[model samples]
Target: MKTTERVEQAFKRIKELLTLVTDWTKQPKEEDALTKEFREKKLQLIEDLYKQLGELNDRFMFTHESEFKTKEYVVQYDALKKKIHDLEK
Candidate 1:
């Protein structure tokens, strides 16, 4: 895919995953009571987040051309990175 498309896809996925993480975080849980199901879901989300981060990093690594440095793509990449950071926390 083109750089813009790749960034857009990553940004979209990050937003979707952020919603999932936010919902998961808002659930009520007992003190230090990490249930098996909750642990499993959290682990899965972390894994998915890491995968997305790696893909975004890889795409940016090879994308040094000025053509791909449009204002829109830069904004999308920044948003994607920020969302990934939030999800990580």
Candidate 2:
């Protein structure tokens, strides 16, 4: 796939995972077991997507510095990490 397509896919996956987490958070206390399970799965999916995004960013960095700057990727990755960390808490 093209670089743009790959980036778009990664973003789409991130958005989906975020939505799942948000939905899981909105559940009531009665289904704590199911909610916790869903949250754990969502967190795992987020981590996997974050790793894929990092790998794609690295590839982009190697191929096109002008289009995909490393510093911007680093900032975005750090922000993502912070968001994930907050979710874990």
Candidate 3:
């Protein structure tokens, strides 16, 4: 698959995982070994996506034409992290 397609899939997967993660995210929840490992892998994938897509000016994901959508992605990502923060407090 082309880089464009790969980028597109990455965004989709991230969105899906973010939703799934947020659903289960709770305050001071203890992760089992397998769950911790899975979360680590997901974080790595997100970091890799940021590195691969960070350079593009016009397109973060091909389907996202407007820059605002890209910013929206960041907003959602931040919100997810913030949710975890808020729940912990």
List per-prediction Cα lDDT, in the order shown. 0.74, 0.81, 0.66
lDDT of 2 by residue, 1-89 (tens): 99999999999999999999999888564767877799889889788867867786777668767887878778877777777677677
In candidate 2, which residue ranges exceed 4 Å CA deviation? 1-32
RMSD of 3: 24.5
Candidate with best TM-score: 2
lDDT, residue 3, model 2: 100
* Shift in Å, residue 21, candidate 1: 32
Q: 1-89 in candidate 1: lDDT tens per residue?
A: 89999999999999999999999889666545467777777768767767776776666667875645557466766776776677567
Error of 3 at 39 (Å): 0.3
Model 3: runs farther than 4 Å from truth?
1-29, 57-89
TM-score of each: 0.40, 0.43, 0.31
TM-score of 2: 0.43
Q: Per the 3 Å backbone cut-off, how many clashing residue pairs does candidate 1 have? A: 0
Candidate 2 residue 26 Cα shift, in angstroms, is 25
Clashes of 2: 0
For model 1, the run of ten residues with the poorest summed lDDT? 65-74
